[model samples]
Target: MQPSHNDQQVDLANTAGDLVPANPSTFSDDDTLSGLEKGPSTTVSSPKIPIPEPADVAEKEPFLYSLRTHKYFITVTILLSLFTDMVTYGIIIPIMPSILEHMGGDSTKTGVLVAVYAAGIMSSSPIFGVLSDKMSSRRKPMIIGLTGLLIATIIFMFAQVYWLLIVARFFQGVSGGAVWTLGLALMTDSFGADEMGIQMGKALIGHTMGMLGGPPIGGLLHDAFGPKAPFYFCLAFAALVIVMLSLLIEVRGDEMQEIRKYAVELRARDLANGIEVKEVVHTSLWKLVTTPRMIAAVTVTTLEAFDLSSLEPTLPYYLKDRFNLTEGQIGLVFIAFTLPTIVSPLAGWVSDRYGAKILCCCAVISAGCFMLVLSIENKPLWGIVLTLVGIGLSTSSFIAPILGEISAVVRRTGDKAAYARAFAIFNIAFSFGMLIGPIIAGYIYHGLGFKWNCITTACILFAFVPIIFFWMGDRKAKMEDVAMYEREEEERKRILAEIAIIKAEKKAAGEA
Candidate 1:
């Protein structure tokens, strides 16, 4: 009455997940790990044989492995790269007026320079994004970009003519494109999409610092050591960034790769499960761009940028004329506008907990209202500063939420999400907004006074708030997203479980 050996073979094949099916002699070598072996011939199932912990198959730790893998270290290194990129961009500001005069250029040429830099960012970001995704590493592109910045700095230092200056600015702009694209993509790779808001907020602190501090530092250096000094200052930072990046490790390359692969395999097995399995999702670029939520995210980023950059050209003049404030004083007032944004980390934290809708809606509304306050006539300087600060604070809503949302959209593309491309779109939108804002604001300010201009911008902000809040978030969508995230978490645990078994079998085989 005993079953034949062939019956046992077929029964084990059915229950063991996947049987070798081939003759056992083919795997007769002692090294044939049981990962490819039958689970067991009995009903209880084979004892869990493989459990690969972090200790198994992990790349050997390199010098400063802990430092390289630390979240804070990754954040700070990116922060310095962003700071250096912005500093190089801004550090030339104080010197531009005098330096341009020597080259027979006027304010109009300066505007051209600004536009060109923005153009460079707009045009080059997508390329960097593609390159980043193709190369599958942020370190190389970042180093190349920073090195390009150093070369641009050298050009700026020696340029004596208007055309040479233009070339240098464009080069700097190209460098800016690479830095922003690769830097942001790197951050996305290092951190989870859920935590993107806070991470982006922290990284942007470098941007704010560069913007606020760059001109002052440039002015001081110019005063003491001439036009070359700011560029010289930038050179030192560039070298430091290069060194820092040299020490930088792409931990995701080593760590998440195997897990992701296992996740993909499991996803294939559960075809209805909707886990993204590609290492790089090949979703058409336009397909992503056309998504409603993606549009909303891009709109928020562009509008926020347009509103902020609009002030750059018009606000200083308004401050100078209305209050008889000196350039130094005007700079101080603008500082108030930027200072509120220093709390972006908190803003990002809020975004992670509650979603981007409420934050973005409230922020835009507050910005519109505060902008209306700015249009009020004869306000005291303190009131103006406070209003600017309020506007700045309102702007904070866009930073983390939009960033997180973009990454979320990419994540939904499943495993093949190309973060670099998604953020490249973001970078282009922002650059476009920055490029056009001043032009539009100048026309409005001249034609209709600052009042209508604020009113016009406020109206635009008003229109988008609903889209941000309602289109981006709702009861049904929120529930769906929650469920999806839970599913993803469960799948992650399952993938880890599989990893455990696979690694454990290999270990057991080695011992046997």
Candidate 2:
């Protein structure tokens, strides 16, 4: 133990040599080793090895922070932009008769203008939607659309001839189509699944106000000044939207990133757990057209739009012919239709709690029933009031819930492009309905009468009830299939765990 210093040093060297491998053959034959032998055998230091932190150990964002961040600005911007467009679109409704009279155009020609605007919207929506996806930027599309809307408004403001106004309206429709489709996309990118319905409901409220207020304001302004006043107002509103958008920050980044991250993590977890993820087949427009929920929702929306288009253009004419109501009176009837918008959030809440299918079916049938009542009723004021209230409440009740459901399905299908495509199809159906509805209503009103036309519209609405039932049944069956799959997954996991335990026990025995 108390040996000399040289002996102690030799023992330490022997212990260190024992730690290294005994095989000299493991050393490489290189010029570096020959230089080392001549230079007194220098030792090299090894680099430190680093361990990576687990992905799951990363910090989770607070729920409230996740919910509130970036949404306020985006939601406000979307609301303002959408409100401007809605006002521009609806302002013409109250002033339609006056403008036609001033231009020496008949009711039929006015109906044609409405149809043309809808057609423009339908045609432009898909193009804008596809462009939005390709561009991957809402800012540019929104700005461009708002700018076009402003230019269109200016053209509309200065137009003297009916043809000029029609041309301006067509441009306005193109801009409006982009605004509506892209605005929804922006919101979807900002909000997640749980909050989307509420935020969308709020946005719809703003839109409803524009729809409700714009016609009345236009009516008042037209009555006070002239037919061109609404256009000037729209121009100012469009300018305001541009200014607001410039000041606002984009909110889509965080939400989109979160969705991508979540998707990646879920896929990774499935792979690590030895689960096979199903591959979805991608296709073109035909694939989207054939999706059952999409088809059903689009059909219902289009038919509903058709019924609405038929009724809206003919309403002012019908009222004037029957009761000779003033512009203000007509505006009031329009307001009645929008009155239910005040309760739309409540409707959305109810829809969230109850199923969308029930709400949609009930609302559609109720609206049809009320339209039938309008056809039978003799008193002009009562009929207008009841019809407006019924249609408003019913339509509002259905819209939020059905849209929520469709959005869910689109997400489940794992296609971001589907939203835009779905909306494009919706607009096409809507436009087709608009083109057909007014022409049919105009012909029926001109040839047959007002009462029969209303009855026909009511019957057309009732036709959707059976269709809704069939659609809802299919949705129920899909849910059942999902439940069965989940149960099977649970059972499979249990069996796998049992097998793994048996294998681990055998390994332990072999080691022993």
Quantify all predictions' global Cα lDDT against the true fold.
0.66, 0.62
Instruction: Give lDDT tens digits, candidate 1, residues 1-512.
Output: 32211111000111112210122222223211111112111112122224345456454667766676567777888888888887776565445556776676543455566556677788899899877765546878889989998998898788888888888888887888888888887787666545667888898777766655565566667777766778888899989988988897775453245444444344444444443232222555786677677788888888887787666656655765677654445556656755776778887877776777777888888898988888898888898888888887888656677777776666555423377888889889888876777667767876777787788888888888767765564333333333433334333344555655555565768942
288-354 per-residue lDDT for model 2 (tens digits): 5566655666666766666666766677787877888877677777887777876666665655555
Q: Which ten residues in a row have the lowest lDDT in candidate 1?
A: 6-15
Record all residue pairs in model 1 with backbone atoms less than 3 Å apart, i.e. clashing.
50-500, 50-501, 50-504, 50-505, 51-500, 51-504, 52-500, 276-415, 281-416
- Candidate 2 lDDT (Cα, 0 to 1): 0.62
In the order shown, what is each candidate's alpha-carbon RMSD?
A: 11.5, 19.8
